[model samples]
Target: MSGITRRSGLLLGGAALLSAAAGAPDRPWAEWDVAVIGAGVTGLSAARNLADHGLRVVVLEARDRIGGQLYTDHGFTSVPVELGAGLIHGAAASTWELVDWAGAETVRVRSEPRAAPGTSVDGAAPPREDESAADYLRRLGVPESDWPPVSDENEPLSRWSAAWMVERGEFDWWSAPRADFRVVGGYDRLLAPLAYGLRIDLGRRVRAVRWSGGGVELVVSGPGGTERVRARRCVATLPIRVLRAADVAFDPPLPAAHRDAIAALDATDAVKLLMEFDRPVLPADADTLAWDGDLDVWSVSRLSPTAPEVVSVWAAGEAARALLALPEDDRFDAGLRALGEAAGQAPPDPVRRTTHDWTRDPHSRGAYLYVPPGAHDAPAALAAPVGGVLFFAGEATTGENTVEGAYDSGYDATDGLLADL
Candidate 1:
């Protein structure tokens, strides 16, 4: 496969599936029909689907908590605020079905335009409308047009850039033909149901997997001693960046082509900062503030629909990288200024605030994966199963690279498992 169109990635990743694990073992080794690594929505969904198919399963999660990025700071507000994977992205039948089963509501939230670098913060700012990010970069002397080639290495970047451009223009990425929705209480609700009964071993970081010939064996360690799992199949629902680090080894090792694809995929480190105001500072009509500053964009979160008092500030690409590099105080100060510039006033002291630094996270290492310019086939290639027993699934494995896409990829992996079974 050469390059996959962004649309293809979205469709390919959205497959449905089922679950199951084989008979139990005697001692030393525990046997399962399938062992799922990572407990995020994709992993949990895959496991749940497998279980539905009468497969016994176990989920091993590195984090002490079950939800990977669907973190909600309950005390932050009366309603839940998502620190990760909050938006539903698209309202697919499967997503809505899961949301309904999980008993969650969808809130309509729109992203304000990202201010171009060097954009004026004065009231005489650019009009609120669709603008090309590439054009903005061209205006700023940023060489965005040259980097992401039309080859395999930079394909995702090219697609992401295209989608990003579409977002800035008179269209929504998923809503051009089909509109999307976000989880009102946050995506945590989406993961809640999937994780209901499955036995998730938290803090159990998988160290290695040996899946060359016989059944797959995974070496996982935690506060307790190292435990090994032998299963008929293993679905690795971890981010590709984690796999690239080789933090977890493979017995026969990933195939050279898979290794190349893994190496080719890029993690666009991103950050989202939450800034509370003494009161709502944005005008009723103004949902976003794009400024020429260290921060890229700021928007009113309306986290709790009724309150509309608090808002979230977000940064991406180089802008997010700059914030991540800042000292704690400087980072907060720069964020405040960006908020002030966008709201047209200095933001009041925050009662509560925090930043989600995806760059610093060990497991994720970054937010989502973006195929550079020319390297589009990597996602599909990454999705290709290894040794039949070793399967891969995650935001990086799918074309959509969104919450819905993640779930779809999980289901698709389960489908693959069922096919081989």
Candidate 2:
């Protein structure tokens, strides 16, 4: 049992297989030791780890490209502009390891002006597990000035879980004055190393996952035609939103607990944009402008001072939904208006406007994970496998709901799969 590259000696009753259908019997069937779904952070890391350990793993990605939420718009500006996730949560974030291994440049920079620490309203007692942070804040009549940042966590207070806040420990560590770091060139640079030597099939969507005691059979659809893939073990790493949307059906249906976990967790709606300006915008002294407006504006230059003269706008949940509601052209206009208001400058319109609405995206229906009310254990429950044949990995399953958590998910899934084998 030193390694498992083929099913010759390690055939566990049935061999892993990929067979083309739709009158293509002449096509060859590809075999794999394990099949990983959705080439996001979780999927990429898991595939890389499993491959390195001598397992013939194949990553089936729904999207045309990998790096799921770690999307970078290199064409938007001179330096890469992050359309999905930007900052590495904190220096302590485990993604830094990949950055180091990839030899990517990063610096501890300020994303916004440092505000008073903690989301606690008037030093109120910690929130109960049954309530949301919004309800708690509203009950305290939290000052309107502090309403915007919710004392500094990314997701708005309404979507937050009061108990989850306590569980996350420190929000200040994620972003404060120079508390976090951004990859200098692009966060997506790590994609190369993770994808290197990995067998990835892009533009292929897994429509169904039929798992039983024998093995897991995945029905996949692509431009070519319909195909079926059978593997001894399966790693499903789709985003929570995609899972909730029922994009892929499990033949016998996932266990009740897994299904419940998928439903219980909340995914935040997110929209990001980059507006190129003639010169630097926002006050030079200010790293981020915490405004009373609906969006937050940050300097792309801060990622690398010499990078570009553009500002990045971020909108979450209702705000993101609102922006998404606007026409494609109007969305950028709205972003510019929000930026001008936040910056207190009636500056001219941007030269270029690049807007990406994650909420409206089919693949990424929302940004990342968040805990609300009483579903604290949902992440772990969702991460749990079924029949020892199907494993799961994603940020929602990690309990932390961060890039680090998503990356760690791969390790966790691979470890479990290895042990079972």
Q: Who wins the lDDT comparison? A: 2
lDDT of 1 by residue, 145-246 (tens): 332221211122223433233323311232133333556666676675566656678899999999965668889998979988889889998886787788
lDDT of 1 at 395: 70
The TM-score leader among the candidates is 2
After best superposition, candidate 2 residue 250: deviation in angstroms? 0.1
lDDT, each prediction: 0.64, 0.73
Residue ranges of candidate 1 with Cα displaced over 4 Å: 1-29, 91-94, 110-180, 285-287, 290-308
Q: Summing lDDT over every window of 10 consecutive residues in candidate 2, give the lowest-scoring window.
A: 12-21
TM-score each candidate. Answer: 0.77, 0.84
TM-score, candidate 2, is 0.84
Query: 191-292 in candidate 2: lDDT tens per residue?
Result: 765666567889899999999988888999999999999888899998888899999999899999999999998787778878888777788776688787
